[model samples]
Target chain A: MIMKNDIILAGVGGQGILSIAAIIGTAAVSRGLYVKQSEVHGMSQRGGDVQSHLRLSSRPIASDLIPTGAADMIISVEPLEALRYLPWLKKEGWIITNTKPFVNIPNYPPLEEVLATIASKPHHVMIDADEIATEIGSARSANMVILGASTICLDLPFEELEQAIRSVFGKKGEEIVHTNLSALRAGRDFALQHKNQA
Target chain B: MQKMILLGDEAIAQGAIDAGLSGIYAYPGTPSTEITEYIIASKEAKNNGIVANWTANEKTAVETALGMSYAGKRAMACMKHVGLNVAADPFINSAVTGINGGLIVVSADDPSMHSSQNEQDSRFYGKFALLPILEPSNQQEAYDMVHYGFDLSEKYQIPVLFRITTRLAHSRSGIERKAKRAQNEMTLPGDLKQFVLLPAIARRRYKGLLGLQPQLENESENSGWNQYTDGPDKSLGIIAAGLAYNYLLENFPEGNIPYPVLKIGQYPLPRLWVEKIANECETLLVLEEGMPVIEEMLKGYLGNCLNIKGRLDGTLPRDGELNPNLVAVALGGKMIRGEEVPSLVVPRPPSLCAGCPHTDSYLALNEAMKVYGKGRVFSDIGCYTLAALPPLEAINSCVDMGASITMAKGAADAGLVPAVAVIGDSTFTHSGITGLLDAVISKSPITILILDNSTTGMTGGQPSAATGRIAEICKGIGVEEEHIRILKPLRKNHDENVKIIAEELAYPGVSVVIPTRECVQTLNRRMREKFKNKKTE
Candidate 1:
């Protein structure tokens, strides 16, 4: 049996990708799994690309960074981010990502072409998480939606994940707490319902 | 139990509040700025009677906190490790004078040189002062230790030093906070002679400190913070300190590393703990962060009996932070490969934020000083200190807070033509005033340029104490009214600022030039708040 699970999250700036990764990392820890989370928030505030490494294990974790192609799962909040981190995903590992494009510089692959290429792979699931986030409330919470949708495949306790979401936003205020929790559940429901269709 | 999320620095501030701190004096520096800021922003602190304010610099902060302790009220002083270097005089002397009420001096250190000038460990300061030092592993212990620290201080009647590095100071952790304790009532010293630090009394106090050495050693020996645990193998032992202990415990394979572990927290190197570990094991690995202080202390105590290994022999890094993998590798465990970070170009050094007011001040200073000659600009630490960096290498010297005025005075007294001291308003008040007084009384012919960007900019824009008083202070300090000039610092008004600076530099008498500008970061933040408020309305 595998002793640990490694997940990679990548995105462009101004997306709520960090929040999504934090929630997953927190949820893993709450479920009694040893978790190590690290991020290069960097000059991301300056509109740079952002990536977070989240590793969960039954045993103790050491480093914050993960080794190449060691990720059991790669979840990208942005389309190009998914492609950018493609090499880090383990052979035959699952890639779950939003189809939204966030191009900082000019001339990247067209959104459809990028998605088509990723879908041609044996292990990929694409969703318009931004639309899902907007329907729920704010498009910023799309990252939370991505985490919520990816939960089914995460093989962790849903109740504990809910607890983690509540824990992070619970102190902010009631409205924010409810909206994020709703976003999380919506993402989860969407992923679970579409697993067979995909 | 009330569960709350707190920043590590905020937890320390809350810890001080919970521990019944009557007063806290601090000079703002990154990683340690929040401790003073949280206290100032707290309604509870104001209502429950805690006096929290930014002193001019670390020296004044230390001196003021010591004065509060003299009145027999619980007090805490806070500063970054470099600030400790500035406050070292009072700090070393405080150990000799001892304390009346409980006292805890917090030195928030920045390891890896994050937002700091140097990574000098505060544990060395603790050892130098021969005072008890406490290093908390995480935020929870940071809070608990603050409370425990005061009690320990009062029990020992010696001020305790609480050291937290950048990682522990910035990391978020859940802390279960308790109700605030009642404040200690003001009490006069029973023996007034003890409070008076005249030479005779100081000598007596120095003797008292010396006599208390054995008791301090005993306290370290029996501290609840230190513990020992048996491991799978008696052949090897682990000596982990502070956060290193947490990392060691986390990486212990099978919850059983082939070593007995001695977790040391209380300092002066618990001889008992070291002896027990050394006697029992053939090989011992020392685990600690930031410095080799503990390993050095152990070498003297444990000798070469145990094959002691740590930062000294590259068992671990002497600088930067420790993670579980480093501890794991030190314990002869399997090497855990980490993600290779994409190689990027060398990072650009931090410069002044775009449109910062200090930019205009530097522009003016750079232009004004060129006529006199190169290397005439004397500056001090503040946001204005960034003027020393590239593109605007305008400042000649920046020793510490208030050193600009004094240093300029020294140069002028030595007959250096057209010397000028450039300092921020917050820095002027912090250590600049006394130096100004020195110039005024001595009639030193130095053109003191008080850069009034009405906030402490470098440490994230805390309120500059001389908001509306810089001009008044210059007047009150006996600066000739004719020489006290205020010019708006703006690129549009750049000509006027430079003209004023030039006029003052040529003046034979002592002069004060006030270049006034609001901190751009503060203005931007306020404008956003105003927009948000208007939308709400």
Candidate 2:
């Protein structure tokens, strides 16, 4: 059977969406998957809501952008950002979003309402990637933690992601790679336990 | 063959490096910036002695590329769609003075206004210059096109216009590489007077350029990039150009679309192929990114009787980029969608970073402008343009690069006293210096705030041309030495900075206040290496 994973990665700009993309993309490439990840650069880098359409397939993929209502999953680091891509998510699509709210706008909705909207989804995983990353002693590893939480929905093996975290962050140092791996496991463990509840 | 996943920009860079490129010049602009950034980061390019310089502006970059071309070596200059306008003088004239070496001018158009002022197509500019244009359908095609483009440029002794949209520029995919060719040795043009475009000489060169049109058209027909595929259905023929071909293919995942499809990756229209397709189908659907250049061409001045459907005929939206669903719906598919976005999710517009120096500088400028009232401040391009939004709402206008200074001068001429112009440091060097010269010549009473964050912050912190040299440049540009105040744009220095700005605004002549600080993002990027070093130790 042909395998395909069309994920929409969403978050506030400067919130490390591209970093998460690097981990997932690196893993996808290692598995001999055809990958097409489109990103937002330039002005949006200054703390704006940014989304990247990441498509990976066993065969050749065409569109860099995933069509409306066709995304397999939306992996976001912020709850509010996760809801913004509702139109792009498939009916039975999985939403793997962090429970933490990145409130940069004055009119940002109440955190409870944002969480409630994400919670209302049939297939979803809400993990506090920030809290988990902080607990792992690397607050900046929140992006990796969120990527880990989405592994349940992703067809790829969990071990592949851990290996990716090492290769992707390996340049920074062994310490970073280790911390990111810890953060990834912390997020994955939480998702496996909460999959049924979600 | 080796394959690596790379963005479209990186593919172009890699393709150039592999295809015997000697130098790459560019001004940092969205989409196009990454092309040069890739070259700068490539260790192979460095070892090969390829020069990648971020020029002061697009114009300088293009001229530098032309100079390298004059020395008989492969050279490339890239810029965003608007940046092309700045580089137009050299870009257009380079065609008249036919090149000796391979020269490719890459312009990345941003459709849908993603990170641009307008979605102007660059193919029209290529057509105007009468140059062969290459638009890649995929990342691999993008990489392949660069090698092909260089050969074509040298074969015809003319510059090739390489156009790509935001999607292709920012999009990443696996690209297969070809064997690397050696860079050209330094040499001179065969003819000594080739570049001198005097009216008499230019007339002869112009004729030569125009004479190459038919051959170029024939070349496009056999280029292999402009593919013609036949399908059983003759009722409708589809014309998918550049990146739109990918979206068209997405709708037909089984590798089958019934209608005959003509994938146009090269330009000059290849009239015979167009006519052949036009004759075969009852109706034509033209799918192209940016404007409907080909569609409009198909519907000539007399308005052909062919039922051509595209952006012009409402088959596709007149504005913005194309997607797979849009192409599907245009092909008579249903409008499929999922859940509506909750109304509670408010707009989270981009703003200055947490420790952004522009935040403090804009705050000080806002406080200084209190007595002068609103609508007096004009801002230019860059991260500082973000200040036009709330809660700072510091600037009033953002038209184009270097427009802030000239617009402020114009406004001050119209009796808007104390008209303040807020321009970024890189932008000041790009086009603002000349505008400042004009202001100083007339002694315009406008106070200018040169927000110096030390890098081109908007395009991801490429090394700035205006770094540490802003004060000296302002002085050199005829600004009164006493009136050019350079201050640190910090929260602690906010009160003093505001006072200085207010004093500058009170001056009867042109006064420049530069609030200098390193961009937070650039600072963070630099510190990461230090952090890594500490960890390793």
Candidate 3:
């Protein structure tokens, strides 16, 4: 079985991009599948645009980097961050992005236009993951929510992801794990509901 | 075999741990920092009494690791590519001294300047020292090669340079474990003066080292790490060294490249295989990262030049890094590119944190510099270098670690009076103090601003070597005690800080102004950790 998924996880630095990768990467590794995750650390973690290339496959993976125009999907926690990695996406690749705008830069373009551009993609899911997370009582779980929304596009089972959440966040205490799980399920539900919508 | 999903740095650390490393020493640096960090945090290492230390600087780290190796215990020293420059003296000298215990110097290079000032490959440093170089193509190799490298080092009684780039350093993949080896028992060298570099013995040792080159190349050929696989398409021969090998394979997803390929994981060029492929194929494609060391070496006499294609010939861009697409394009294929990034997406450059002390310090410095005009502040490496870009635009130069002080002194000598030098606390100890002494002895009219953030914030808040000692260090360096002023870098103290800065700038002699504050990120992290413990209660 030749199973493979190349994902580009994008967001503003410190938005927990690595945490999301930890969850998915752990899930894939637990299944005894091949996993390669490349991270951006050091200077860029100080509130700059950052991205991680996460590859999962049944067979041994060759490259740590996802080749240009070969990513299976782009899962972004911020709207503008979503469009930053368009070059890495496949022709029919899915783009799952949060609707929130991280306006750190002075000249961040209009949010509506960014959202509309994401909307123009053939396969896209626009989500208010921050709002969904906040409504569920944990604003910090927005990244988990975004990760949850991308699960539909990912080939892994939901139970595998839920187990991954438990293992990755196990040391942080049960409350955080619960809140993040709720955020994840809420995000997954939103994607399930709005996946086919115009 | 046990499996662990590990970053390449972590894999190397684990590899070293399993290979019976008695100690590891390093100064924190991107890509390479995690290697020492992993060992420091390992429970097994603690149980086994393995020593892991964060040294004052790369030079000190290498010397300390060499001391450990001197005791007949396996030791490792790690740092980024440029850090090797700081440790070059000991590193090169160690080659002449030989070793009783295995010594591996791991240099994590940044090929694309991802988190570095420049991209300098460490393999050349290895070759220059006449030592075998191991360049792992992936995480598993990164792990296995540690054992192989240690064996090679002990076998030859010489040091091995293990080079890795930012991608391999930062990327994570599966790594399989080998059986654990016991640490070497303390045993002195058979000769008492083995380490002493007296000219009489040095010539003999140097000759011995020179004699080891062919044997080293033979080891490279026989080592399983270097492989030469034949392909049906002999028209274009490919030499993919280190991580470039992975990219070549990535371009061929089916694992079938239509060319004769030489995979170079261990270097000294793996001469026999190189000559074999060179003789068998028509044209050669050198797909190595960083500079074209292989390509340059291949272009030896122009007599046997077989149309070598790489960075030198512009087949691939001379600068930056090599990805699968770049390799694909070099192989006469079109690179895959999708829609261009929309104009709406502005560049979000990395900046200081919202409550960063560097922000307030740079702000106050900008106000003081208004009187002296601009372009006199020479900033050194650290988070404050981010001030080079932004609303502050406070600094004019950031050349390297601890360059700010010397550069400022040079400018002052050249009649740029009131020249300002901005350096971080950690960097000051790293390389700044001697420059400070130089300024004091010469009595240069330079105002030095040391941004004391109490921690090395750039590389994830490693413990600083200069914590709480900047003032005393300055006073000890012979700067006038009265001129060495410490100010709190905060918004409420902005005007006062600016006043102090201006007054120091007007001083005729050397003056050190320290803006002391805890890094906002470290502070936040501490508070979060404290809160988490409370929650755990």
Native-to-model Cα distance after best TM-score fit, residue B502 in candidate 1, in Å? 4.5
Could you tell me which residue pairs clash in candidate 1? A66-B339, B56-B430
Could you give the candidate ranking by lDDT, starting with the highest? 3, 2, 1
Model 1 lDDT vs. the true structure? 0.78
Error of 1 at A46 (Å): 10
Model 2 TM-score, 2 decimals: 0.98
* Top candidate by DockQ: 2
Q: Please write out the lDDT profile of model 1 over residues A72-151, one tens digit for every residue.
A: 87888877677666656776677788888766444455667777766766676677888998998777778878888788
B-chain TM-scores per prediction: 0.90, 0.99, 0.98
Candidate 1 structure quality by residue, lDDT tens digits, B194-221: 6567898888988888888778778778
Worst 10 residues of 2 chain B by lDDT: B528-537
**Candidate 3 C-alpha lDDT tens digits along B181-292:** 9999999888889999999989999999999999999998999888999999889999999999988999888988889999999978788999999999999999998888
Clashing pairs in 3: none
Candidates ranked by TM-score, best first?
A: 3, 2, 1
Which regions of candidate 3 are displaced past 4 Å?
Answer: A196-198, B301-304
- What are the clashing pairs of model 2? none
lDDT of 2 at B245: 95
The DockQ values of the predictions, listed in order, are 0.14, 0.88, 0.87
**Model 2, residue B333: C-alpha shift (Å):** 0.8
Q: Ten residues in a row with the worst lDDT in model 1 chain B?
A: B338-347
CAPRI quality of model 1 = incorrect
